[model samples]
Target: MNNWTRKHNKFSVQNRLTPTARELWQWLLDEMPEGSNEIIDLRDFNKWVKRTRGFPHDRKTVKSAAQQLLDKGVLTQAKSYTAYVWKWRLQPIRVLMPPPFRKPQKKLTFQSEIPNLDPSNPQPLKDEYLTTTTDLEDAESGEFEQKLQACRKAGIYYYPKDAQFMHGFSLQEVLKAIIYFLFNRDGVRHPEGWFKVCLEDNWAGKEKERHQLRVQWSTEGLFEAIRYCNQKMGMA
Candidate 1:
């Protein structure tokens, strides 16, 4: 039998392996050669389910089990077209070994006397930068009225200076940053390609993909890129 055939047959080895092992075997076969370390497209698994007879319900169950295996260091997920794909590591699974006991590293503690600020040379408080708009209605309302009426008196107004600091980046900039980090920095091309496909597919037009991208990029991508560039070029 070929590797795929052998793999498929392994699923039907009734009494040879435990129930959990059999389930895991089937799941791994669904992913094929990509089982442990390489990424496999989830859509492929969905298609496989449709093709197979007597498939398990709660389709997410397989995914959840795969995730559990991943967490246990038994599998790794790689980025595929608009989704995380599964890959199986080729390494032999070793039985859990007892952790060796060792002395904990001593924690270093230090205390410094607080420097007294000179009254004559007192530093001025830096102005807070407005990041997000709290309320459109309050913003349209006069500042004085907002302060008086709103419980959260911290009213919104456009701060051109602060806005300039976080210059509204174009979508190209976002895509470039994602590509540079995923491909250039991390040497992981899968995520970069996935993102490109996502944009091409207009996945953002659909709420699901768009929201996921926005959240990931806004929180992790932009933050990391800004920090990296700042550190490298000494620009705050």
Candidate 2:
């Protein structure tokens, strides 16, 4: 959900990695939110690993694993301010769904249905959106329409261009951005104008309560769908 981070399929990225290197790479992915742009301090991670694994691995041991990931282009080292502290960023290679081979297949569709609100009896907002996926034009466009409808249902002013601009994020993330606007829209004269800025920066992912809501689909889910496509192609 982090703006700087992108969703990737863990299984796909785990391909062809050494056991130690794979473990370390998986740890980095699990330790941080998907697509997080924050720099990871390896010293702290190593300490945490020692506590969890019940064995103190030498600095060289962990560094060797990191080196493997670096060589494989799974991680990138950042310019660190101190020699003692090493900062690293996970950068998984982009994997695409292989094209259909034998025959044409149905398009993947993501379904979302917002509850029709009763104006006479106002109730507190809940995670009441009903969702189901089926065949559609594409996941992003279908999700955009669903999210747009949800915004209208919630009395939020969401524009088509705004939805199109934010099509890069998954359905759930886009919904979270909408929820973020609602939670923070108090005292603002123009909710629509403020929402544009929120979408640009993705303030929803930063909110603590944003994680509490049940999201319909995540960016990771989209990539997982791609993985499914790859599996169908016998390339996963």
Candidate 3:
């Protein structure tokens, strides 16, 4: 696997890693032979980044990042000083979109004023809206059930009210919340509580943003690889 190279491939949870942390991980995967332990000296990594990544990182910064990775379980400290070991893990779960969840509805325009309407009569409008949107309600309910089952599979149980609250968001957004929970759940003791807070604060959007950033970073890496190859061919 030493010569194995993957390009334009998506990482399991790229947004969870900082730049230095990610570089350190890549360095471990590259420099450490399989079933071997090596000292994680940042000075050597500094040279590597200068030569390959076209940038330089201070030893202190790299060391701090390494420590952070250790604390986060991304790297394990070996018995020897400064030496570390890395492990491979399964990829994150992917959320598959089922058939069109809901049909788009035409825009609704409310009248400036309604004549012959009693101020005390509130049931008519509410009942009419519910009747008109029954199909939409059913679609959203089905989608909510799908997301609930997914969370259950991931061992994230949501209460009845919690499920109702989550139903307010799109299924894709809710799934992002689940992904966020799974990726960053290293020290979380109460997953259900964490998920409830996540829903209340709408952390799903943050996950979506991270996903976008990961895609952008991956694209940049792909281009950098291409440029490196071009430079090497030119030298040859």
User: Highest lDDT, which number?
Assistant: 3
Tens digits of lDDT, candidate 1, 141-226: 34423222221221222232211111122334334444333333344334423333333334444645667777766567778988
The sequence of per-residue lDDT tens digits that candidate 3 reaches over residues 89-158 is 3111121112334444434455425697554555576687768767665765687789888889878886
Minimum summed lDDT over a 10-residue window in model 3 is located at: 3-12
Screening candidate 3 with a backbone cut-off below 3 angstroms (N, C-alpha, C), the clashing residue pairs are none
Candidate 3 has a TM-score of: 0.32
Better lDDT candidate (2, 3): 3
Ranking by lDDT: 3, 2, 1
TM-scores, all candidates, are 0.25, 0.32, 0.32
Clashing residue pair totals per candidate (backbone < 3 A): 10, 2, 0
Worst 10 residues of 1 by lDDT: 160-169
Q: Which parts of model 3 are misplaced by more than 4 Å?
A: 1-133, 207-236
Q: How do the residues 30-134 of candidate 2 rate in per-residue lDDT, one tens digit apiece?
A: 666543445666676667655643444567766776777667666665556553355666664342223224433334354424466343332222222112212
Question: Candidate 2 lDDT (Cα, whole model)?
Answer: 0.55
User: What are the lDDT figures for the candidates, one per model?
Assistant: 0.39, 0.55, 0.58
Residue 212 in candidate 2 has what lDDT? Answer: 56
Runs of candidate 2 exceeding 4 Å displacement: 1-16, 92-236
The 10 consecutive residues of candidate 2 with the worst lDDT sum are 125-134
**How close to the true structure is residue 180 of candidate 3, measured as C-alpha lDDT?**
79
